[model samples]
Target: MKILANDGIDPIGKKILEDAGFIVDTVHIPQDELINRLNEYDAVTVRSATKLRQALIDACPNIKVIGRGGVGMDNIDVDYARSKGINVVNTPAASSHSVAELVFAHLLNGVRFLYDSNRKMPVEGNSNFGGLKKAYAAGVELQGKVLGVVGFGRIGRETAKIGLALGMKVIYSDLFEGPISLKLNFTAGVEVEVPVEQVELAEIFKQADFISLHVPFTDKPVIGKEEFDLLKDGVGLVNASRGGVIDELALVEALNSGKVSFAGIDVFDNEPTPRQEILTHPKISLTPHIGAATNEAQERIGEELANLLIEGLKK
Candidate 1:
């Protein structure tokens, strides 16, 4: 069988599929060319750069499996594809730690105002060293602060483990009703289990000193003006989940009004071209949606995806 890795798979995964008696193509077929050429393959894999919507799914009758290399199938019409007897799968566990670590990368940058300092230091460091030092001297610490995680899935749990290890109290809100246990592992073979209870969404917003969102994409923004209004003054916020999870306009307003002290945004409402306000905000630390872009995460994702496709194609 032939597989088209539309967004390009790791060489490890490509070799795995080939060794398993399947042909793999890593060429990136442009979006316009997919409908014409995709049906030639038995399976297709993608990351965030490609879309497998209903139209493309309907057009490709030969495709047996639709594999997403990472979590979040917002780019793929999963339910619709499944309804058409096509298997839709994603590697939800593969990139959890990488994404979790990126959340902290942004959070740490925000708390210390590194984003602003890095930008201004290159221009004003020599002339205004003392002034810049005074400007950034009010940075706060993350230890002993309340961290609110808005979802409690794999990535969310990983984030909570880090928060606990950092001496931060972690609270979370999820769709599930029960408390969850997280096991923290150390380099010296030591492990500790911590139990955390789920809190109401409003309560998380009100009590948390730092909030990191981990929910999936929704039709509307989860953290809008009303949610922002419920936050503690000078609260730190991080969004590494999906775009539009937090309202960009409301976030800017909050930052400007001091309702939110600083924000770390990895995802944006618009991809490739986020709003100028969000891009230019001095109080916001930004990354171009690279939450799961780590080499380790890609390796895991590739191995997991290859295994899933191998299993799926045999059915």
Candidate 2:
């Protein structure tokens, strides 16, 4: 069988599929060209860049399986494809740790003012060292702070584990109805199970000193003006989840009005071309949707994708 990795796969995964007697092509077919060329392959794998919508799926009848390299299948018409007997799969577990770690990368950057300092230091460090020090002296510690997690799935659990390790209190809100225990592992072969409290969505906004969002994309913004009004003054936020989860306009207002102190944002409402206001915000720490772009995550995504495709296509 032939597979087209439209967004490219790691060499390790490519070799794995090749060794399993499948021809894997890593060439990136342009989105416009895919409707004409994609039918030659039995399976196709993609990351966030590619879209396998209903029209593309219906156009290519030979495609037996559609694999997403990471979590969030918003770009794919999963139900319609499944209804047509196409197996749709994603590597949800592979990027959990990487994305979780990035949440902290932003949180830490926000709390310490590193995002602003990094920009200013190169320009004004030598000129006004004492002045810059006075500017950034109000930073707070993460220890003993309340961390509010809006979703409690695989990535949320990993984020909570890190918060517990840092001596912070972790509270979460999810669709599930009960408290759950998470096991934290250390480098010295030590493991401890900690209990995390489940609270209502409004409770998270009221009590949390720092909030990190880990939910899927919805038709409307989850954190809009009304939701922002419920938050504590000067609360910090991080969004490594999908775009449009937090309303960009409301976030800017919150930051400008001091309702929110700072934000660490990975995804954007307008990807590849976010609004100028979000891009130039002084209180925002930005990354270009690289929550799962780490080398380790990509390798795991590739391996998991290869295995799933083998299982899916072999049948």
Candidate 3:
């Protein structure tokens, strides 16, 4: 069987699939040529960069399976692919830790003003050290604070574990109905099990001191004027999930009104070229969507995708 890793797969994953008697091709095909050559391969794997739309899926009559290296299927037309009996698989667990850590990175960066300090200190350390220190001195502590997790998926669960360890109270709201119980094992051979308390969307909005969004993208943003109004004033927000989940315009308004004290945004509605207002906003902390950019996560994602492809295509 011929498999194409269009956006490039890790060497380890490619070797694993090749050992299983599948011919793996690591070709970076142009978007214009993708549909024309779709029928050439039995399976294709892609990262977030590639877009596997319905037209591409319709053109690929020979495609048996589609593998995603990382989480989030916003780039791919998953429902359309599945409608045509194409198996759409993603390595959701591979990037859980990386994304969870990024949540904390943004949370910590925003609360501590680390991003601003790191930037300004280097340039103005000698001249305005005292001034900068006083400006960023009134930082909030994470301990004893309420952290609201919007989605209780793998990434959200992992983020909650970190929050629990840091002495922050965690409350989550999800589309699914049930109690979530998780057991976390520490490096020293210690395990801590906690039953995560589930709450309503309204409660999360009202109670949380810090809100970190983990839900999927939809036509309407989850965080807007109504949700922001429910939240306590000066609440911090972190969005490492998909873009367009949080309304950027509403967020800017909240920041200006002091409803949202600070925001940490990893994903943007317009990636690579975000709006100038968000980029220049002093209260917003931004990263270029590096949630799953860690080396370990990439390797794990590759291996997981390879296994999924092998299992799926072979059957």
Number of backbone clashes in candidate 1? 0
- Model 3's TM-score against the true structure: 0.95
> TM-scores of all models?
0.98, 0.99, 0.95
Give all candidate RMSDs, comma-separated.
1.0, 0.8, 1.5
Better model by lDDT: candidate 1 vs candidate 2: 2
In model 1, where do residues sit more than 4 Å from their true spots? none
TM-score for candidate 1: 0.98
lDDT of 1 by residue, 1-315 (tens): 999999888878888999999999998999999999999999999999899999999999999999999999999998999999999999999999999999898888988999999999999999999999999999888898999999989899999999989988889999887566678999989999887768999999889999999999888888999889999999999999999999999999999999999999999988979999999999999899999999999999999999999999998
The lDDT, on a scale of 0 to 1, for candidate 1 is 0.93
Q: Cα lDDT of all candidates, in order?
A: 0.93, 0.95, 0.90
Model 2 spans with C-alpha error above 4 angstroms: none
- Of 2 and 3, the candidate ranking higher by TM-score: 2
Q: Which residue pairs overlap in candidate 1's backbone? A: none
lDDT of 2 by residue, 34-92 (tens): 99999999999999999999899999999999999999999999999999999999999
